[model samples]
Target: MAGDRDWWFDEAAGPLIRPYAMTRGRTRPGAPNLNLVTQIRASRNRSDLSQLTPEHQEIVDLCERPLSVAEIAAYLNIPLVVAKILISDLLELGDVVAGAPFQTSDIVDTKFLQAVLDGIRRI
Candidate 1:
């Protein structure tokens, strides 16, 4: 019955492969265009995708509607860096397009912060 259970996750079986192994210990991709919120889209011409690994194709399929790198990572249950590497690979293969997200930065208001602090002190 011990053999009946899945061995992929069994540490004693020596069958577990670390997620970073697929990336060959690469923490950062060579691509500089990738960011957490950058959108990815399947290219109109996906012929290049045929030469890629099935995993890459799956990633492309997920990007058919333009999902951000973070969304892809969350949906696939993979690390953010892994998703970036995948996206970078797809970009190199011309199978995916990277789109810029709207840039916005929060401006802190000192008066609002003080008022919130005062309200909290009263409570």
Candidate 2:
């Protein structure tokens, strides 16, 4: 009877591998500072990647150009949490580097605000 069962589900069936399976059920990144705006880029060292899973290797390739964590998630077609986990693994392996996000002081700078206002007023 098992052999006779339908092999495929309907078109709406979800991905074969759940996100948790990809990250081995890791919900938190080892590096806690990786926020949505944090920029990620490939490291120059170029360590051996044969030990990494395909997803991990793909992430390294994706980060050749600096990209925000949110952009990495969008590019990988994975959840934000999963992207973080993958990036954390890459970080531990020294395959990539994460750039700090803008500080609150930079966002609140009076000069930057005035520039924005001036540009808006010109339009």
Candidate 3:
């Protein structure tokens, strides 16, 4: 799957497809940096995103607030995987900024929260 980035499965073989996983050093406290998960997600998000897509625009807009990948994903009603892709793209484009750790808060929107709960019920 070196060249086929989206090839996540081998259907005919009935085996799990493996994508290349690169590793990098973790960020230290009070350091200015990006996490590997964030980088990967952002790259994937930007790969096919267009300016007109609400999801894409939402990501871009949220980055202005320096929201984490998890926060953005939850806010946009998109899968974490999808949010990661968008975040990675924004990071590469310098559209997203990293910041020091801050106070954690539970601030999920009702619409997104309901959608997530609905998905859980279906599953």
Candidate 4:
């Protein structure tokens, strides 16, 4: 008797049976094989970040402080992947600088070294 059609059931089923509800198949872990078809599909769906809106430009500007992609994503409340895309776009447009210049001095501050070690441990 409780199986009767109801508004809640209809609303729930709508999302469950939606075309976009299917899982995106996973890539073989660490495999070097890249499929051309998948590349083409991704290219078709990819957003051109270079042609960004004002909001996206704001996000890019926030990334100029040398934060990691994860940090940038957290600051902007966006996915890390999206942040990476924006960073990549900025890099292409010569709006971002790459890795810090290597210092000739072998001396690194103990606290900075410890922080790097801690980060490595988390990964």
Candidate 4: C-alpha lDDT: 0.43
lDDT of 3 by residue, 1-123 (tens): 122322433536421422112101212212224443332222223434464344455566555445666677566544455555555545556545555444334545778778888999999
Candidate 2 lDDT tens digits, 1-123: 222222421336634567898899989999999999999999998679998876788789888898999998886667999999999999988999998765656586788888989999999
The C-alpha TM-scores of every prediction are 0.64, 0.73, 0.39, 0.39
Better of 1 and 2 by TM-score: 2
Tens digit per residue, CA lDDT, model 1, 1-123: 234324444655443656677566888876887888898999987766567764577789888898999998876556888888878888887889998874433436778778888999999
Q: Rate the local accuracy (lDDT) of all candidates.
A: 0.76, 0.83, 0.47, 0.43
Every model: Cα RMSD to truth = 8.1, 8.0, 11.3, 13.6
lDDT of 3: 0.47
Highest TM-score: which candidate?
2
Poorest lDDT segment (10 consecutive residues) of candidate 2: 1-10
lDDT of 4 at 110: 77
Q: Could you tell me the lDDT of residue 4 within candidate 1?
A: 31
Worst 10 residues of 1 by lDDT: 1-10
Candidate 2 — which residues are off by over 4 angstroms?
1-14, 102-119
Rank order by lDDT, top first?
2, 1, 3, 4
Clashes of each: 0, 0, 11, 0
Candidate 1: which stretches are off by over 4 Å?
Answer: 1-17, 102-123
